[model samples]
Target: MNTKLKHLVRKIRKNSTAAENILWKELRNKRQGSTFRKQHSFPSYVVAFYCYEKRIIVEIDDQIRTPRSLYNHAREKQLTREGFIILRFTNVEICRDLESVMKKIREKL
Candidate 1:
């Protein structure tokens, strides 16, 4: 990653949302039986959480809109083509019932 991208990643990690922070606690430090990185930056995109060992990328969508939805679909297709399994959850799901979200991630694992 370039310096600008690295700085952007750091800024994101520093200003994470409540849901991201909650999920990060569970994904950090191999707590989920595998290593994961927060605000992981790829050459073209930055994902919420990524498990390189499993090629899994967890995305927390804060909102649903036409443009964002389209962008996410395209991004998902590209990432899937690269052999990644994308797991997306909403802020409500993360805060309302985190265990279910974790269960889904574990199932993927």
Candidate 2:
């Protein structure tokens, strides 16, 4: 990541959405048996959360179906091509049923 992207990542980390904050409580500090970085930047994308050791990227989408949108489809393809698994959960899902969300992430790890 370039300096600009690093700054952007920092900005994002400071101003996290409610859902991101809620999930971060569980994902931070090796709470899940692996370290996860929030607002992790790639060359062209800033992932919601990333686990470098497991090559996993967890994304929190605003819309429930945004994961299937064209842009996300292409992004997911590129990330998977790079051998990263992308897990997507919507804001509603995170706020409503965090246990299920954590369950899925645990399964991935």
Candidate 3:
């Protein structure tokens, strides 16, 4: 990993959003025996959370202006090709209905 990328990841981990913090609480302690890394940096892009055991990437999508960005599509395609599952959740949805998000993650796991 590049020094710059590692720095950014550390910065993000320190300055996490409310939703990310809340979700981290649930994902911590190897929730369901699944260890999750927050602010994880992949070779292609930085992910909100990563589970190496299941090869899953969890992304909190807060920007609704574009719905989904070209960058995200490209990133998703690349991750898919790499055989990793990508899970995306809106910030509002996560804040309002976290149990549902957790349920989805459990199903994926």
Candidate 4:
């Protein structure tokens, strides 16, 4: 890994956001026999959550201040073209009811 990427991974490991921590606990140890990595580097992009075995990428959208629908749509399209399935959930959804989110992920898996 490049120095920047190594640093980013370290940061991800050491300073996971609340949602990332909660989700990582479930995703670690191959929860579905699928490995997950945080702050995964893609082509010129950094994904929040990635499962290579399942070809899935999960993005937790907080959207605290501005609308990101347009940009997210573009990113989703790019990932789809690259044979990745992208799943997005709002912070509210993740914080309030993660089981449903996990179920959605399993469905994709």
lDDT of each: 0.91, 0.92, 0.87, 0.80
Clashing residue pairs found in predicted model 4? none
Which pairs of residues have clashing backbones in candidate 1?
none
lDDT of 1 by residue, 1-109 (tens): 9999989899988889899999999999899899999889999889999999999999998854233587889998999999999999989999999999999999998
Sequence-dependent TM-score of model 3: 0.92
* TM-score of candidate 2 versus the correct structure, residues matched by position: 0.90
The better-scoring model by lDDT among 1 and 3 is 1
Q: How many backbone clashes does candidate 3 have?
A: 0
Off by over 4 Å in 3: 64-66
lDDT of 4: 0.80
Alpha carbon lDDT of residue 90, candidate 3? 83
Clashes of each: 0, 0, 0, 0
Stretches of candidate 1 exceeding 4 Å from the true structure: 64-68
- Global local distance difference test of model 3: 0.87
- TM-scores, all candidates, are 0.92, 0.90, 0.92, 0.81
* Model 2 weakest lDDT span, ten residues long: 60-69
lDDT per residue (tens digit) for residues 1-109 in model 2: 7888889888888888999999999999999999999888899889999999999999988854365789888889999999999999999999999999999999999
